[model samples]
Target: AAAQAAAWLAGGGLPDPEAGLKWGYMEGATDYLFEEREPSPGVAYVRLVPVLRAEPTGHDLIDELLREPRSWRWDGHGESMDWWPAVLPSHREVVAVNYLPHLLYQWNHAGVYPPYLEALCQADGPVGDATAIALAYFLSTDAERGVPLLLRMAARGDLPAAAVGRQLTHLIRRAGHQTRPVVAALAVAAREGAYEQVWEILRAMLPGLLPGEGERPNVTHTEAVTLAADVATWAKAGGEVPATVSAYAMSKRTSRFARECRRLRTQLT
Candidate 1:
């Protein structure tokens, strides 16, 4: 899965304790087994898996989550599942995207927004997971709060920039919300010297900016255009530069991909 791929890319490997043992795949291998090289033993082995996601005892809230509709979308990385309207009745670390509107409405009307927001802020899980996306969208209802929250997370490396960008684009498609705040958050991250991560995030947003072969531009297209324009302006500023801008600035650098940066620069310009 994408998570596994990410772990591998970051130099994470299986926790194998046994030497010269089962090294071949078995049924359900993908679900439980991971392989690591062990030169000392001339082979590698496995460790018994533990419950990675443990639920609190008497966690009755799961019933409410199960009752929500099950819907998801696949990306190059993997699947992302979320419910519509993006709110929840009782805030939990994991939430139903569909119930968010109702949940937010009730919370606001009942003067209980803090508990829900607090839950989103404190809830922990995998990086760039569904809950993170939901939190970004839910917090976005109040940009003053949401934008800074996202920026802080990105700056601190708590949330991946690509995840935040993709989730913001998804939010635009589902909620018809503006993404200016999100773009600004990205700019803040760029200023904090996260140029490489910011560039990947912006690259994820590029699909939204370009039109299909024969399709007419829509509201989403316009929003994407506006986002790109803002990013371009930030790129030209005298402060910390965005990766796209830096790639063009340092085209001779061996690490930079000049052609790709030039292509995106041409579009944004």
Candidate 2:
């Protein structure tokens, strides 16, 4: 049925301008069916009915049909299916249904710093934070566009800062810590001195590292302890860590790691 439909449309089996078909620019029509028409060489009047429907089942049907070799042909033959009647609903439907929501979820976040950190905690798997971070970083190059998206994600609590930071670190290590597009985007944000934006991305991730059953694996007690010490040292040197940073410092940890972080912070200062 699908192949016959496709073949018929390709052969102008339904209607044509010479057939005086009046489809009236249907928005979503895969093929046109000729209902009534006056056949003439130079003068013909035909009324066209859209063959494709917009219902979900109809979409599935079209998808199945398009995948079949028998339903479509792309050769340069006369009246080829290549330029036959337009496909219904269009490619925009595919993006709207599948890609855009996932993309928006990942991209509209704090930024790379926190999201990266979160990625480190996930077990090696396909649907991990790592994938999200990679995608967000790819899309983050457009600062004007990307920054707002990040902020939107942050506002929505879709991403956290610590996670982002870890992800960034992972990506840095993967890229040999050298300047790549993702790093460059961060550098640009840093140079622009968008500290609030940077902080938000970072702060969002901090809650995940708090002492709890769901605490992330990447942000171990030792790392958290060391990070706290680093924050203090940075603070003493007139650098202010976000409130979330200090909050994370209060989590449970080994005394040795805690002491070591504090010692490191002091030494660094």
Candidate 3:
């Protein structure tokens, strides 16, 4: 049912079950997805959850996704079933764990701040540890969402800072040129008073995002430095800019990178 909603919102009808796989919701999505929607925090997640997650949480969930329109059989009806909006009682929990995350992800791709997932990223308890390990192990699917979640979790002493830091580095590198929104999210978080938590993630992320310590700066690097400066300024950050940034600031007196470095460096003092 949710998958149909995904399909409908994505500008298509429900996909056939017998039909082979589908593309990323067809990219023909209507403007509904951009309306800024998310489920209430009260929506069920940890409660009634399976003690053992089904083999990590990304691909498997996608594999189990319900793409066909939901329908059901009636006792009086012929063998053919009715295809409309209906949920089989048995499939409730299945959808919660398997389909809900993806739906939530589609809605809040940039926010990536799902509290339930954050709750799952706990360290000590079995559920928490399992989730933390699962998310960290195959972060390629989780990077956009999981990286920032880990930062917040680590800040609260729920997960390890070093490990979270490493993932932040991986996220920055993996995102490559697309790291703009990710960086913007951090800056927004800092501007909203998450300075220390955001800075910790940035310290790990910035070096890789920037050109190497003394390597020649390019347009890409220029953008990276500018974004970092935006973050540092918002965070009111109090620490050294990365060596790469500092060296570049000194390398060219008037280039864009140097100018961004000056703005970034000033925040440190």
Where model 3 places Cα greater than 4 Å from the true spot, the runs are: 1-116, 122-162, 172-177, 213-220, 230-236
**CA lDDT, every prediction?**
0.42, 0.35, 0.44
TM-scores, all models, native as reference: 0.42, 0.26, 0.43
Question: Candidate 3's error at 59, in angstroms?
Answer: 32
Go through the candidates in order and give the C-alpha RMSD of each one to the true structure. Answer: 16.3, 21.9, 16.2
Q: Which residue runs of candidate 1 sit more than 4 Å off their true CA positions? A: 1-115, 127-129, 138-140, 179-181, 192-196, 215-269
Question: 231 in model 3: Cα distance from truth in Å?
Answer: 4.2
Kindly give the number of clashing pairs for every candidate.
Answer: 7, 29, 0
Per-residue lDDT over 35-148 for candidate 3, one digit per residue giving the tens place of the 0 to 100 score:
144323332221111221232223343444444322221243222111111332222223222222232223323222234354344322222222332333223344557556
Which pairs clash (backbone N, Cα, C closer than 3 Å) in model 1? 83-97, 83-98, 84-98, 86-100, 87-99, 87-100, 87-101
